[model samples]
Target: MERPLKGSAPNADDEQLLRGRVYGRDHDDPDPGPLPHQTYAALVGGPLDGLLLDITGWRTEEVDDGVALITELGRWPGGRALYDPRSGEPRTPGPGVSCRFYYSGDTP
Candidate 1:
């Protein structure tokens, strides 16, 4: 489902789902780690130049153009979904999106 606008207050259900995704629970995956790599897909509009999406650490900020998602560039996991272009996962990165891996600077 499409996410609510940046400044929009999520409904109870939406908020609950967001919380579950962020914090994880018996149903969802745990916090993917401090510096987990991820793919950033633009749900609406086009991509911005020089923008990096670090899956592990990211935040949605409102800019004059709307919402801006910022992330860092890092190493990609080996054959993992984090950076795989085609992992066959239901939520694999989509079109007009970019992917990057991250490192938390902690020993695994």
Candidate 2:
């Protein structure tokens, strides 16, 4: 995915591309934020999304259906927004968050 230039807007094609992407998080994890330095995993479907963080040493792999984006979330002692703030549960990475993408089969 491409970020629009400052003060510029995305054209119709960019909008359509974004619409075809999918994102998900671990529903079983109860922590709102990942424990400092702990490994975390999220689900990615459809086309792969772009990186928000240039975190090094991240890994990705193919799954049975979609893809698995795995990374070790760096420590956040205060418990940051890595997870849903409202519910403190793992969920799809949204704005301002970062996740790595891995693919083995077809994607959007």
Candidate 3:
């Protein structure tokens, strides 16, 4: 199946394209975000409506049916938001402490 953008619902045209153009298609302009990395394997084995997501570039309450929403920003490359802050197990990557920091584009 063709995958859609992360954190957002699939559009009708994209769904149709996935069904229609699974075979060889010509390449176009490059994608906007960094290609998905190995750290993107955390979302699995559950319905995704209420999962705590924390990856970069995802809108809050974003929904996707093709793949699980990414829920971990890389704090230390191999480490992720799932790493527990206290018990050292995989905890949900909720919002970080509300801190005043410099930002470039948009604020969440």
Ranking by lDDT: 2, 1, 3
Write one digit per residue (lDDT tens) for candidate 1, span 12-53. 454344331321222245552222344353222111122233
Q: What is the C-alpha lDDT profile of model 2 across 1-108, one tens digit per residue?
A: 455443333445544543322323332345333334433333232222222222223343221122233322212221112221122333343233333334232211
Comparing 1 and 2 on lDDT, the stronger one: 2
Candidate 3 lDDT by residue in tens digits, 50-92:
1222343433233121221222122222222222112223422
lDDT of 2: 0.31
Off by over 4 Å in 3: 1-5, 27-108
Candidate 1 wrong stretches, greater than 4 Å: 1-8, 22-67, 70-108
* Residue 61 miss distance in model 2 (angstroms): 29
Ten contiguous residues minimizing lDDT sum, candidate 2: 76-85
In angstroms, the error of model 3 at 56 is 36
List lDDT for all candidates, in order.
0.28, 0.31, 0.26
| TM-scores for every candidate against the unseen true structure | 0.20, 0.19, 0.18
